[model samples]
Target: MSNLIQPGETLRVLVFGAHPDDCDVSMGGTVLRYVQAGARVQFVSLTNGNKGHQSILPVALAKRRQDEAEAAAAIFGVEKYTILSHEDCELTADLATRRQVTTLIRAFAPHLVFSPRLCDYHPDHRATAQLIQDASYIVNVPHWCQNAPIRGVTPVIYFVRDSFRYPRELRPDVLVPIDEQLDILLTALCCHESQFFEWLPHDKGIREVPDADHPEERKAFIRKYWLDVRKQYDRNRFFSCLQERFGEAAKAIGHVDAFELSEYGNQPTEEDMEFLFPFPVYRRETWKTTGQRS
Candidate 1:
């Protein structure tokens, strides 16, 4: 086995977000926790978030968001912040986009890959998820694309949590707590002031929070809204599952982000699971607590 799989090896991960703030919102805490545990993490935004703000020019907003992302990455000790320069709100899971993602996947060659689910309300999120799924196998196919170097080994893939419930499609087999990394996540989140303070609610069809009336309360409301999206909706069960797998170390925490182990990529072994998921997991006995199993 490689030294990276050793007891104290630095776990590496690659996170893909459709927008500038997607990773921060969806898996920020997990990112923070990974860093805290001596993991090397990187962020990739499929788009520059040029269309993220109002009362600002597109070019200017993109640059601002990029700067903010860099600052946030610094806060989390992220090694790199890669922007694909794709236009926001118009992202498509085309061949070109998939190829770009493949290159990053090969270049990073992370043990784990995290990205949005295919069922999100946002088109960009859905597109990115599809792109990731497609590229999951493409990265390992030597002859798939001759131009770029192929990553022969397929890394384990996982999907980020979505708050919304859409009838009968649920695939999450694991949850990782972010409570330990909440502070770092928040610090990174604050970098996207434009979206969190201005645009996310507005774009989500939520009424805008006016600055004149209880600005702090409005900020609190927005924060809570995101927290609900990120934390509630089976997050607790996820933590419980982590507790089962990782024991007390992964438990004894609050706030969890969920993910569905992807069936499209390489199937990780027990050892891989031990490395990639260093959290307590749900046992048959504990399964009753959540009325579920992993």
Candidate 2:
């Protein structure tokens, strides 16, 4: 069967991330676009984010992150959000992990699955990527996981971009313009209070402190940090990728989410990508008219 989503069909999408905030940080805009288009989307975090904070205990931190993830899912309008009970930074692509992934794949039976790239800076990210790849084929096998029903076909899979600059370069096959969705994306990402307002800043040695107990102060701190630091440093790479693909018009694209086709899953054509994204073609033409190249 063709992997193209049929007319008027609601696409079922599943995205896997290493931690509670990974999916939202990486692809929140794309996920929001999917939801706005009426697609059913599910986000799965392989780890419970137990060690994400500097001060919070593991158990308390896990619960806080889970609640934050739930709040983010609500913001994104995601149909389902799950955080597996795996410990932070300890995920591995072992047989047990593969089985758990396969069971989820069989249960969700998604049309498209999103995973992190293998060459990530974090161990859990790399392990989650490998686990997803390993489980893609077995998801269709009838007897692989007896607890879950078998899926006749494996979902088309793609890898979300990572910040790591090693092993292999990222070459994206699809670029979804997220300029209009930036506010929504930021809103969803802000839901991950532990990560954005606490852990990340601490990890990076940024001195702008976050008061997790004070909601208004936390929001202000996160906004300042994101705008002054994260947006320029991290998000610029995404814009550069877009400019490479879409030319100077891509500069008009304030933000974008990129994906690479994974070899371990069903292959999709250029037309399939176009169908899946469904962004305005006129934006490209508009770039030609007013862009620096033209």
Candidate 3:
């Protein structure tokens, strides 16, 4: 089905992540752009993020993570942030999980859905991908998820790029430049204090949290920490994608997010790409001759 959004339409987006901060880390900038353009977005964490902290107990950690997620959502003006009760580090692509995802899809009726790439280091990330893939078509099936109304068309699904490498590589179908939204993205990410300051640093064998009790000092450290991480993992490829699309001017873009189309959802055309991304498309000569937005 060609479920392409038209120009000037208010789009609906649903993003699924394995844990609380995953969505913000991967596509927070893109979500910011969408919201600025008046799109409605729902960020859903498939797991409770109970296991994220190195020291906090599961119950307390889960509540803390949920509160963090809510705070982050408020930063983006996203009203519908959902965290499923599934235990952290234990997500599975089982029948029940698929049904739950399908139910959410039908209830939201989003025009586009985003999830982690199938090739991921974390099992929960992999499982979340499988659940999204399994639910893509099922959401459109009449008999599935009886409590929710079946959507007439399946949402277009895209997978966020992961840092891990595999024997068979995954390539991005779209690169969304996020330079303008970098500060906002970092602010949203900072809300996930448990992950950024505690869990990730412990996982990486480094002390990420600063000793300073001042809020600005802490924010500065988190911003720099993530910027360094992004530079190490994604900066080069993101620039390459931008250069390929918009030529030399892309070098000015310092940050970006990448996404790959999934086979399980709506097949988008070139026109669909224009509608969905709405970024300034530039040809080398066009930018060189006339400094105008394409």
Candidate 4:
């Protein structure tokens, strides 16, 4: 792991998730592309997922989750990983937890931070999002955490997609094409053995994908699972966004994942967008609601 404050170099990104697999499931492709583009990416999990399954022992489950997370990180080429060791299903937006996130923001000084949106059924997910959102804004405030150094600039915050939202207000402002990296995403997700085969079961009970000695059977199993998930997402929207950004080539693509711009600190300018994201094309909604001029 390369740990040094270089004078002028790569962009740093910090991804915070409520559970071990959240980051990988949502932003794994984007993370991989960032790392491949020579940026430093660090993933942090607020909870170790010990209480995720009742049948398994907590200690053993935690250990398995940690190992799986490490393996997934390795797949993404992420250098740094931090697990908060908090009990699963018990996260809160308390001062101490906020400070823990603040400490990391200070340490990494990431240019971009990805977290869950504040609209969710899970308490831990909502709490994690709130904590990260608060820490992102307050990290630069010297009075909040005096010991930690202030961030140079306020980082851009992004919200990951959720399975369901009650109010259904969250909207995507960014859609990154993951067609090339879907295989990697699947492999990374499959690392979490407990979540896939152990805990994930429909109303008809757990449907096990046959993993036989034959490579064809395994590939078919993976393809079926991946295709079903791909069908659930609004590929058309993502493809449109991608086409806007990447032109005709993007239009030819099939599937992609979306991300909503939950919070844009200080309102990034056009130049800033070019410097930070560098996507070729995009459309910005007029800031009419907030009475903020574009």
Candidate 5:
């Protein structure tokens, strides 16, 4: 087998989200970068997103979200997109769920794992974070997830961007510019018809919904609405760190995604950050002089 399957030989990133579109909406751009850099990446939804739709039944909504997730994964060409059968709005970080998550981490044996932060308002988001955190260490224990073999190294865990500030705000350790991949990231999000073009707009209390028949108009609306939302989350944060990695090109970067290293998992050193995030090489060090940080 290739080194990708062997533990610690390759860089593997596995991202877990509470709902179907959560991973795509949060980390899609950065995951696309990882895929481009030949690192194996996987997106897993801890819940099936059954309760995401307002009108659709839970079973049908679950299926639709799974289909949407697969479509999005194809666009990014990631290795796996797994939507667990747990119902939405009801995720709990119980032992069984912890073992289930542990199995996934053991199966992938990733070097990097990302999930939502625990400070979020959503219960499922909090639960997903708890599950991943609980599994962070057990994934390396031989007897914990008995069915799945364990890897020697514990995967580094990161919290996907969140603006919540109850206990503390998210502290970004790595900031990545994804301007070139922004279109692809947006396109990947458009795959989640139920979430982006429909449910999210309705959830946000948008009065005028995008027309379903006009795919082009819907896509355009999706782009504009999400881009506006993204600006609030991504556009204005982390200039100093981005400049350090990306050089002065950080100023021109209209779109970006960030990761906050979690205290529960492996603490990555600077070298690990360089290999894991790989922004300069992604653009092949194009800004060799002026745009580069002094």
Candidate 6:
């Protein structure tokens, strides 16, 4: 069967991340775009995000992060949100975990899978990436995880954008314009207090962090301080890819999401991308109403 999903047919997307808010930070806007197009999106955090907070203990932080994940998932109206019990900074893509990941892929039978690249900074992120890669072929083998039915066709896998100039930089196969619904991403991030409001600021050595408790102030801080930093990375690194995909419109985009095609999953053609990436289905009224869900 062709990987291209028809307009009337609902799209199923499964996203795996190392930490609780990784999916929200990485692809929140793109996920909103999918849900707007009537796609069923599910987010899974491979780790419990226990080690992210400086003051909070591991067990307490893990529980707090789980609550934050549920809140953020509600913001996107995803089909489900799942958090695995793996220890932070200690995740391994061993055979047992690989089998578990394969079962997840087979159970959801996603049309496309979103995963981080094999490396960036975090060990958990790298392990999650390796997990997805290892499960790519096994997702189609019925005997691998006999309880869960096989996906039959391997889902096309895409690595979320990353910037690390070591072995090879990412090649942009898809560029998404998030200017329309950038606020939704921001609103979603507001749910993760420990990461956005506390730890990240301290980690960066920023003396004056936002009063993350206040809603209006928090939103403004996220936009001015955090998202702007991300915008710098995205613009300088991926503007050319945006120009390639979006042409003249790319010049005006304030926020963009970039993705790279993975060699392990089903290879999609240009036409297939039309269906795979639902940027064309975008409507101004569609996303402006996202607040209704929030």
The TM-scores of all predictions, comma-separated, are 0.82, 0.84, 0.88, 0.84, 0.88, 0.89
lDDT for 108 (candidate 4):
87
Residue-by-residue lDDT tens digits, candidate 5, 1-294: 122234445678898999988888887888888888888899999999999777999999999989999999999989899989999999999999999999888888788889998899999999999998888767777777678877675777778888777798767665666778877877787889888767787899887766667766766677688754663355576566666656776678777676777667766554555666766522222112112112
Indicate which candidate wins on TM-score: 6
Clashes of each: 12, 0, 0, 0, 0, 0
lDDT of 6: 0.79
Please, what are the lDDT tens digits per residue for candidate 1 over residues 1-294? 422254655678999999877887778877777776778899999998898776778999999999988888888788999988999889999999888999889887788999887888879888999999989876877886677776444677778777556753545566665666665566567667778767776677777554534545544564577775557545564555666666767645557777777767656655566677665533222122331113
**Candidate 5 Cα lDDT to native:** 0.77
Query: CA lDDT of 81 in candidate 3?
Result: 88
Better of 3 and 6 by lDDT: 6
1-294 in candidate 2: lDDT tens per residue?
354455666678899998998888778878888898877899999999899889999999999999999999999999888999999999999998898899888787787899998887789999999999888777877677888888564577888865466777665566677667766676677788788867888898987675657666665665576632433443466565566667788666655566777766766554555555666421122212221211
Q: Tell me model 1's lDDT, rounded to 2 decimals.
A: 0.74
Query: Residue by residue across 171-214, what tens digits does model 6's lDDT show?
Result: 66666777777777788889998988899888877676667567
- Which lDDT tens digits does candidate 3 get at residues 9-91? 66788999999888887888888988887789999999999998889999999999999999999998786889999999999
**Alpha carbon lDDT of residue 98, candidate 3?**
93
**Top candidate, metric lDDT:** 6
Candidate 4 segments exceeding 4 Å error: 1-7, 163-165, 202-204, 212-232, 237-240, 246-251, 264-266, 278-294
Off by over 4 Å in 2: 1-8, 210-248, 280-294
TM-score, model 6 to reference: 0.89
- The TM-score, computed over Cα atoms with residue i paired to residue i, of candidate 5 is 0.88
State the lDDT at 257 in candidate 1.
74
Tens digits of lDDT, candidate 4, 1-294: 112233475678788898898787767877877776788899999988888774889999999999989998998999877899889999989999999999988888877788888888778888999998778667888888888888575676777766465778546565666667767766776776677546653322647655435445444454465443642364563455666667878655655556666544434444444444543334344232322225
* Per-model C-alpha RMSD: 5.2, 6.3, 5.8, 4.5, 6.0, 7.2
Ranking by TM-score: 6, 3, 5, 4, 2, 1
The deviation in Å at residue 30 for candidate 1 is 0.8
Model 3 bad stretches (over 4 Å): 6-9, 231-233, 281-294
